[model samples]
Target: MQRHSARPLAALATIGTLVLTGCGTESANAGAEAASSTGAGRTIHAQKFMRLTQVHDETGMTLLEGPTFGKDGGLFVVDVTAPEGEPKVMRVNVGKKTLRAVHTDGRGTYTSAQFSPYDGRLYLSDFSHGEIVSLAPGGGDKRTFFSGEVDGAQMNPDDIAFDEAGNLYVSDTRGLSENEAHGRVVRISRDGTKATVLAKDLAAPNGISFDLNDRGLWFSELTEDRISYLRLDGEGKVTSRHTAIRVDGGIAQTDSIAVDADGNLYQGLHGRPAMAVYDRHGERLATVELPSRTEGLESATNVAITPGGTKAYMTVSGPDGGYLYTFDALAEGIRQSNGG
Candidate 1:
């Protein structure tokens, strides 16, 4: 009787093992892949280059954005929260690590600082006033280039980029979260004569970049947590569009973007203290983390690679203050990376 019971128990154990092994192979493989992909990137720590915490308004917060190199090789940045009469557009000296205000004014929350390659003048996106403004190389002759409504709606211009033809592109992000479907990608002719709507009803398109060889236009959608690629025609009209990359930020949101000479993308995060690196094929390569990630440096917002070099700088802000961090890039920087 004892031998009979033992034999039956052993057979039952074998049956249970077979059932588990025969369970959905696809499900098992997916689980294994997800497990291996957790924390799936190389870790690269960055060094803090500049401290920007001391400069803030009554809100006691400072956001350093738009780390792009000017024609003079200095990095131009903007402070979106600086009060009127304060330095809203500033430049960074890489060697000396110094800051200088190039432009300032009221009712204009300049979020991006970019120098036009054609005219050799500086352009800024006024997020507060929904206007695209320009400044001379010496910060003089400030002018509003784009203002008021477009297609019977107010324009909430966020980030600005220039194409190879000197045509300007603007991301009008005003209605993603509210589902008002008012986001648009507007293009201004190189001659500044016509303003055409390239794409509209986007999901809060924020950071935009033009690819070399006119391959495609890369733009980040904040609400959907993804980067979109638009193939435009010679007239700045979209021929085809596709999703370049999708991000799983959890609490974080995608901000500005920069592209390298090899077409790799550096995406900034709003709540996370790290930048995600992706290859041209949308495969993630690494995550650039701040040395002070847990020490109050949480907002890693944008990155700019040194033109013709791999040196990269990121704009960061947190409860402690705003900061500039530096690291080595995965590839050489392209012209779009300059003030992207």
Candidate 2:
């Protein structure tokens, strides 16, 4: 079970706004009442807040990751296929709700896809190959941007983020066993020349995002069941560290995380059938349960919200395969590194 620290005022304020914009007061209040009675804080049924729909599906696609929005509002995702099929970077046609492969020749397991705000190119993390590759905007000109070992350990980069100056931050989840916590957070220079380790000894750091205020870097430790904040100096050196949220009952299996414009954090709870929402202070705001457990929607691995915050796109994986899901959201998402 997951436990949240007390910060009721911020949570209530967020709930109040949700009650006003998400639905009429009555329905939202009813959902809140039901969730509060269960001692799970203020909550709203996901369906009541937004409609959940499947935008795309394929048989050989064994996993799905990264539904990040490009500068032009187009969504990019990765399809991690079987051994016989190569992984693909796909672009989501938001209007038609369809997908088109952007990079069909990608090698290894593509775990995360991000569009650079400064250069307008797509960057992907190849977990199996231990490298970060770059692709042209329309999926052409694929090249290896960063690779090789970090601190004597191979790079098993899991997720990627960029700061305002175009410097890239990667979370390297590089442990073979459950007790071996050898994860690391590294920063690559804007020119892609120099690599520096900002922190080490992380227990499977998976999800990473910049705070809306640009004050610190936020990341999740999956095995440790905690989300933490790190303040970096002008040269990308770690100055301080703080635990934002930690699961008291053991592993929460947290994966990808996203931040909205108003400083709310939306995190994918891997083993649970829901997404956890937290305030800037790391207080629990609510949990939005995905619909239809029969569809293998329980394993949420990544989440991305649109710029206007009208809808949220999530990547879920299970024994059967992977899926891309979209639903209505309560607030606008933070798109840029500086929270513009």
TM-score leader: 1
lDDT of 1 by residue, 207-299 (tens): 888876666788887777898899988777899988889987787777778888888888887668788878878888777776432476556
Which ranges of candidate 1 are over 4 A from the true structure?
Answer: 1-36, 53-55, 176-179
Local distance difference test, per candidate? 0.71, 0.65
**lDDT (0-100) at residue 166 of candidate 1?**
73
Pick by lDDT: which candidate is best? 1
* Candidate 2 TM-score, true structure as reference: 0.81
Q: What is the C-alpha RMSD of each candidate to the true structure, in Å?
A: 16.8, 10.2
